[model samples]
Target: MADPGLLGPQRRALILDLVKRSGAVRVADLVEQLGVSDMTIRRDLDALARAGEVEKIYGGAVASGARAEEPGFEAKTHLASGAKAALADAAAALVEPGSVVAVSAGTTAYAVASRLLQVRGLTVVTNSLPVADLLRDNVADVAGTGPTLLLTGGTPTPSAALVGPLADQAIRSLYVDLLIIGAHGVSERAGLTTPNLAEAQTNRALIAAARRVVAVADHSKWGVVGLSAFAALTEIDCFVTDDGLDAPARAALEESVGRLIVAGSAEDSAG
Candidate 1:
């Protein structure tokens, strides 16, 4: 009986969701985006803090540090149930009918790869073993026919990515229409980040090869910055995310990107 777009309580839910993705946010930004008083925004933050969804910092709030540890496939698979599905859907729609799409290695990329099976005449180049495995194993069973799947060769990370000079070199010569990237953390100021240096270089290679870059992330990716910077948000053309994103987080991403696609929403709005 309540619309998040209209109700204050629902609005707080949206804000909390945004804060969760973004590690930290300033109070001023929330106030302006929510079109509410400082007190109202503070109350919203207070509620989220009480609920253990976010912890209040000096200037703003951030998500609880419950899952910062690098999780395995089985682990992250159960983490954000609906958000991952929604992110996958959004990432999948961006793939063209007949095109070369390079999928980066990560849990989010795996989701995108799984959804991309719906498309015909797709050549998927990826560095994730699980991604190739998913494509290789299901190409016939899915009935869409086999699109050329290129697996990058390199040293593998615990997260299942092939990251090294060999993989980077292979990615250099190739080109693709779209690149669906997965990130450990995404921040407006810090851009996209990860813990692995090789993976970061490979991500750079992916960014270089693709005509358009689309960052696939749920609300959990926002605000958090990692050791290595993958790509500046400005380098990306589009961002595919779930509807849980707050207006400020969307706006922050929009500043770096030209278009934003909210998962499950047909609407495309500018920042």
Candidate 2:
């Protein structure tokens, strides 16, 4: 019988499963079980850390566990998969190298961060833990080549965002080339909104600190008003959304925002 060596992702999947079952996994054990070297195990851990799949500690890795109070970050990744991917790709294309950018906390923004990972010489300031973790974990790949990652340290919310006064204070004074934000909902009545009031305030500060504001939301978010509104429709420079948006809503948004970009199709621009 021939030995079938495991591939990278396959090996990583097994490692993740082991971590989940054991709560924590040791490097020595993984090396022995996978028949790989200690260096290979460490590299796998590093990649998993970058993807927010596991928490890498000094000796080994730990599984991600969600508190009863907060929604698990892993769960959010599954929502609006296609729409978020399209929106993220479109948004990432707008980011130029060496640009100063701000990304707010949300699954959609997380998607954008994933795409922006390879962009070189970008100075990214963000309030999302997942975004910060993604960039930080990729430090080796981006060393001297990728963006300088900055986090707005502050109070954390149920969604894993650092918000409140500390985040607001940091954002109010700085300036960035572009700010990308995801909203709970969008409507003619309520511009851009989120369920969290503190997040709303923090987002307003982000809007004020940037030269351009690009709002990313899927069709499902349309007309679903949240508890707080951050910015008015006219205040947004460009609105990026998925093709799932209906023609009438698209027309209305085009009339409202400075420009409207529908991902996965020719843009419907209004300037």
Candidate 3:
């Protein structure tokens, strides 16, 4: 149980955090954890619901909206981190030096950007604030001039993505040799989906402005349909994913995508 003297707002905030992390929180558990009466906990949940922070269910509350279930930047970084790193490495290897590349905003895309720090004589465009900051800070070459980093301006989403009409407009006039995108979910049927509608709209622009599209995702993304489908599986030139992806998914993607690279395997197997 939490401290008896804890404030109401603080308790509600704690409950919100828990629900965001775990997807749902039971009223009974909240009552036990907060050391409050059932009625009090329900009142708190009701308040949160009224505020549109959460959706009230039978026994508890879930995330507010379908897209609201999308994990924030910090939360996603901890999920399948090792696999994401491997996928990023594989995806980065496909980027040729001196190429103009656009990297979408996601934890996996951030990982890919981290690996591209040493890719000299390149121009990288991105809609992710963290990705731009990472490249600006760590990039260095013999001439002390690193990649030309371009950032798209827009409203920031929960995933730290700059997504809106501004981002779309920024990408319209530009063309890139490659674009690496990460998804909230990927499946044979639903294709590449994302929880955020604005991000989805921005991603569509990225795809349109690129000659080649490489998608980076972990095995866990398979079969999880998000709120919006941004791109179909056939739109991807190369799909880089962890070796943990099941064979059936690999088979389907291999047929749909132009190429598939499995990271953390004995070899970079093509699907």
Candidate 4:
């Protein structure tokens, strides 16, 4: 037994975080992580369920239909520190100088924007506030590298992201060389998914407006499936992920997509 009164709000937040990060979490894992009883975790989940914060499944919970399970921008900014950085570098490598690129909204996308600071004489169009902020913040850091930045104008999401009809319309006008997207989940069967269907629509617009599509994600994004999908593996030009993908994943990528770049670095930290 555990004390919900003592860990009430904190417990809810912890479970929510795990649900978002892991996509779905088992009851037993929650008990161990929170040092709480299964009953306690269930109660916490029930509370979140009543609020319509998450949808309870047989063994776990996933983001609700109304909103993404992802936490606020601040929470995402600090997660998977080394992995995000490594993944970002791998993503940035795919971009050639002077090319027009469209980046999607997500912390991992923001990380990609951070590394793109040095990609001089280029143009970047994005719908992410954090990514725009990162591009502006790192301008000076990019002494020899600078790009012309363009931001999509629209209403912000709960995550303070820009997406809606206006953003979609804005994105529709631009035909870019490459569009790099971020996904909450990337599965071979379900494809690239996100919790918000509207975001999915906007992402689909991005995919349609670009010549080549690249998805930059970490290993955590594997196995989870969201309500809405953006593109099938066949539509993607390249899939850039860490080198830790298992044999099945590698085979799946080979069987499904055109090219899969398992961003192998000299100092690989995929483990």
lDDT of each: 0.80, 0.83, 0.86, 0.77
lDDT of 2 at 129: 97
Better by lDDT, candidate 4 or 3: 3
Every model's Cα RMSD, please? 12.0, 17.6, 10.8, 10.5
- Choose the strongest candidate by TM-score: 3
lDDT of 3 by residue, 157-260 (tens): 98999999999999998999999999988878668977677898999999999999999999998876565678999999899999999989988999999888
Estimate, for each residue in 1-271, the C-alpha lDDT of model 1 and write its tens digit: 2232557678877787676565555577787777777887788888887888876754566567623345566666666678889888877887888999999988888888898886888999999999999999988886766677999889988788899999999999999999999898888876887756678899999999999998888888887655456888888788888888888998888777868888867657664
Worst 10 residues of 2 by lDDT: 63-72
Ranking by lDDT: 3, 2, 1, 4
Candidate 2 lDDT over residue span 178-259, tens digit each: 9999987777766786656688899999999999999999888886655456899999998999999998889889888988
Residue by residue across 134-203, what tens digits does model 4's lDDT show? 7777777778578788999888765557888999999999999988888878877767877666788889
Query: Candidate 2, which segments miss by more than 4 Å at Cα?
Result: 1-72
Looking at model 3, residue 23 earns an lDDT score of: 56
Taking all chains together, each candidate's TM-score versus the true structure is 0.73, 0.72, 0.74, 0.72
How much is the lDDT of residue 95 in candidate 1?
83
Model 2, residue pairs in steric clash: 122-147
| Model 2 per-residue lDDT at 161 | 90
